[model samples]
Target: MTRRASATISTQPSVTDAPLRYRLIHDQLKNAIALGKIAPGLVLLEGPVARVFGTSRVPVRKAFEMLHAGGLLHTFEGRGYVVASPDGSAPPPLRAPLSESALGFDEAHAPLALPSNSERIYHAMEAAVSIGITFGHFRIDESEAAEAFGVSRGTVREALSRLRDLGLVEKSAYSHWLCGPLTARAVAHDYELRVLLEPAALRASMPHLSKEKLTLALAEVERAIDEPDSIDADALERIETALHVECLSQAPNKKLLGMIGHAHMPLTVNHAFYNAFNLHPEAGTLVEHRAVLKHLLAGSTEAAVTALADHLHAGQKRTLQRLKVLAVLPEPDLPVFMHRIS
Candidate 1:
């Protein structure tokens, strides 16, 4: 057998102590963007960037390349790169606040529209989760996403970056990305966090949850439960998230509500596990949710809390069991972190 070539090694002195030149450049430019020093849509030329950084073109070029890859910079055939904008213009105008009228259905009977970013991000997230659950953990490159979404690479990148920020996807050391193969421990831990946070949220806002909001939430849940096909796991996941979010929205604590909102990924991933294992039938879930809803409607906070806790624990147990059967998760010990609904 032919011997493998000796591994090549760099001869340069270790620059471990020195500031990473490219990272510095990256931060500086990012700050400029954030501070509006370079306005949106302004072109960033490598030669000019090098001169500004007082360095050779190599590092600046590399930095620009990195930014471009990150979707913060847009590249064209002849014009080099410019700041990427989601809409390619000034940001869209703000919409009116959500109102009772706004919550009403159209003649065609679709649910009222949510914000564009919310809708787009939600759909993209569902697709990402579905792909992850079915295919195992896999990295999605920008080009693949661009084609998949029928949008520009910049839009896809922007979405991916958002997902990354949400902890739904993580970038690998080798530049690959992974969605989920979410360990059971991680799932249990996330649910524990949710349980600790969500019930308290519902209790705090139970008085504020208006009839309109309840109606909207109930409709969403019913729609999800009534879906004809079992394989539409994405729809089921969305409906599930919507139900929990609707409950949390009743809480008047904006900060706490925001935290609950951010908990969606873990919730979605956990539910995906539930779907994979068929832990509970639709009728079973409907019965559980109905019990919780009845307690809430009756203003029985303690009863609602108990019901919600039991429901969440059931889900956690099912997920953990499935993980064990798959041989992909370790057996959890006593006093294991469980999703607490405080």
Candidate 2:
């Protein structure tokens, strides 16, 4: 039995967040080499450079490739990549833009939230899959995705498998990955499962629910529902996680928690609803959330379960109604890494 913690939901993804350590390293290295700090013809060892970037050799190798491609570095005869002269003169350290923070040091922050290259690829693929499904059914070509993301076929498959585990993707008989055409029926069906599983998880977590934590979560919901113009991305994430992820963390069953983790209606629907209507979770949703939390804090498991059911039912109702409008919206522009095979 593993005690779960707050759900590690990915933030609203932009292309900027998509995994690209190599690109980031490459760009920084380009700037460094161009400014002559590395010195022309000095060897760039993979191990030392990787340690500096707080990453392994893989992304650093990728970075080297980009630098080699851009003529800032060169490969010796089966030896190593050495810095190449940008021009006849060594460049001074060019000042970074005032808008940029000088925190390239690994301890302070990373260029991305995901730590590993594979994790970054996973997020990038998830975003691509989500937008693809919203538009229509599409067969994801594994090899093509590998080529597109500049990763191996294994990495592409691994990322796809994670998405499949999330219930946002599926494999066809021919071993091809398929994603959806989001519809009224599918949305309602998903909510049906949520109504049962989520509340049970909450009930299971009752013993672990803390007064302070529940109070904080309940307060977040109140602020979002009661405050004017509280429909920003973080507010939605806070309220949604407070109910769906944080409360469910109290469940001791690892398998149950894993199953609940895959159901991302809070992230998906709430994000889409906000995009379409410029609104957060509707007022009634907050009231139901508050009621469930209030009951749980009071040790009334039965009341919490009932209120949770009503909350999910209402969410399902509203979600289905909004699907029509979302269905008509244009497909988002996605990266080459995801090849949508209709």
Candidate 3:
């Protein structure tokens, strides 16, 4: 039996100026413990709490650490935390099935609003910029993008800021946003960093990778391989994400995860190439994916990590070739914001 969270607290941001996400989670769990909605000896795990909040486990783990520091939660000889007994005495762990309403978000307080305007438009902007860069040097008009997306310039600016963080776009000396002419050197540079960083991230993530999750990821790869004709650029991207982003998402080091994300500029190139050519990922690409996923499912963490690095190594050549092809082809129709500069 597994104990579950049972809480009643507002998800709304507090009056304080601090970031709301982690603070909200902390407050919710603290209130639950104080109210005895969560029993004194019940176990609370990061995974379940994260699922309830529809967020990543990192913040949930942070909240748990905060609770332990505050003496609201204490460590037992187990994986998760135990709620502190009110009388300053240790109690046996309480394990039982939780009620339907237990650990549920209150309907009135549910945080179900759509993401901010910037987030909503970010992927589309990223895709457009990624594809645009393959053609030649270009300038992005902030005002034009605002009009095209029916958003404010400020919103567009924020989205572009994120793009800059990922090294997708940069400001020229004249202060215009420019995306390029992705060079082979840049592709190789990204892979060089990935081969070092991604394998380490995968090793850190192995402890958290559940068998079921790996199985589903492997199944997706196999499906793409079997039905290559049915696999489009979008499907190819999905399989790539299953291994790269989603699989590695559970790593606890925030800075490491951010670095891994920043190093993925090459992913956009691969995606844009497949879409441009109306092609699927190469068979070798799918086979490499299958190999890594299979090793993970077999509990060979080192082998899986090594396989991932090998895949990246192979992918660099493929991506570089695609870039060469795109460089030679006539520029396709671009979005309103983009203007070819060279």
lDDT of 1 by residue, 1-342 (tens): 011232221111112333555777787666555555454565566665555455667777888888777777776654557675654443323223322222121222232222333335444444444324332454556665555445576765666677765567777798765666557667677678778888888788778777675666566566546753442445556556645777767687888877766655555554544444443335555566767776777778889888887777776776565555545433221111111111
The TM-score ranking, best first, is 2, 3, 1
For candidate 3, the 10 contiguous residues with the lowest summed lDDT are 1-10
RMSD of each: 18.2, 9.0, 15.9
User: Candidate 2 — which residues are off by over 4 angstroms?
Assistant: 1-15, 18-54, 57-114, 228-230, 262-279, 330-342
lDDT of 3 by residue, 220-298 (tens): 8888778787788788888889988888888998798898888899997677666655665688999999999999989
The 10-residue segment of model 2 with minimum total lDDT is: 1-10
> TM-score: which is higher, 1 or 2?
2
Task: Order the candidate numbers by lDDT, best to worst.
Answer: 3, 2, 1
lDDT score, residue 193, model 1? 73
Q: Which stretches of candidate 1 lie over 4 Å from their true place?
A: 1-125, 131-136, 147-150, 172-176, 212-239, 270-280, 321-342
Candidate 3 ranges with C-alpha deviation above 4 Å: 1-116, 172-175
Q: Model 2 residue 281 lDDT?
A: 57
- Per-candidate TM-scores read 0.50, 0.66, 0.65
lDDT to native, each model? 0.57, 0.68, 0.78
Q: Which residue pairs does candidate 3 place in steric collision?
A: none
| Best model number under lDDT | 3
